[model samples]
Target: MKRQGGFTLIELVVVIVILGILAVTAAPRFLNLQDDARNSALDGLKGAIAGASGITYGKAAIDGVESLENQTISAGNETINIDFGYPADLAALEAVVDGLEADWSNAASGAAILFGYDGYNQRCVSYTPATGANVPAVTEVIEGCGTNF
Candidate 1:
C-alpha cells in the first residue's frame, strides 16, 4: 500500500491528544500569570496614591507650590489637574477611578498590576493583566488629607 501524504487517523488523534494535554498543563500557569499581573498593577496604584497624598498635603520633601487650583500630578506622561473643590473635580476622578478599579478587580484579579501617571500628559494608570490585557484604566484620585472639598 502507498503511504498517505497526510497524517493517518491514529496519528491525527495522537496529535490532538498531545495538544490537549499541553493546553491543560499550560492553562493553570497562564491563569496564575494573569493573577500576578493584576496584583502588581494594584500595588503600583497604591504606591502612586500614597505618593500623591504627600504631594497633595505638602508633606513631600520636594519643593513646589501646591495649590489645588493649579496643582497637577503626573504619572509618566499622564497628568491630572487637582481642583478638589470644583463641582466636577471629585465626581470626574471618582467616575474614572471607579470604572477602572472595577475593570481591574474583575478582569485582572491577581496579576502584578502597575499604575502610572502622565501616560500622555494625562493622569491615568495603565493596568496590564497577566494575559497581557493592557487596559490603560484610570485609578482612584489622589485624595489629599483633610480635603473637605
Candidate 2:
C-alpha cells in the first residue's frame, strides 16, 4: 500500500474516458456551428443582394441606362462591375468583390455583392468558414438557398 509517484493505470483510464466523453459530446456541437454560421451568412448575403439590387436598379432607372449587363464603374483606383443577368452572375462582379473581408460568415459565401456606379457602390458581403462550411455547390438545396442572389 505504498503511494505512487505517478498516476495509476486506473486513474489514467478514467481521465481518458472522461476526455473521450467530452469530445464525443462536443464534436457534434462544434460541427453544428458551421451550419449556424452558414445560415447567418446566407441571411446577410440576401440582405446585401437586395440592397445592391435596389441601388443598381435605382441608378439604372434614374440614368436611363438600359441593359446594365457587363457595365464597369471606376471608383478611385478601383473598378466596380455590375451584372444584370437573368439570374445572378457572380463572375462578372468578382473583381470589385476584392473589397470583401474574407471572414464574412453572414451571407454571400465569403463574397460581396455590390450595387451602384462609381460613387454609388454599396456592398452586401457574406462570409464562409475557412474550413469550407460554405463551399459552393450545385445541389438543389444550394440553388434554393440562392434564389435571392
lDDT of each: 0.39, 0.42
Error of 1 at 43 (Å): 1.1
User: How much is the lDDT of residue 60 in candidate 1?
Assistant: 13
Give the local distance difference test score of model 1.
0.39
Q: What does the lDDT come to for candidate 2?
A: 0.42
Among these predicted structures, which one has the highest lDDT? 2
User: Model 1 compared with the native: what TM-score?
Assistant: 0.35
Poorest lDDT segment (10 consecutive residues) of candidate 2? 132-141
lDDT of 2 by residue, 1-149 (tens): 99769998999999999999999999998877755665565455555544444454454445553244545544356544543311124542333234323533223443433222122112223322112213321211132333132
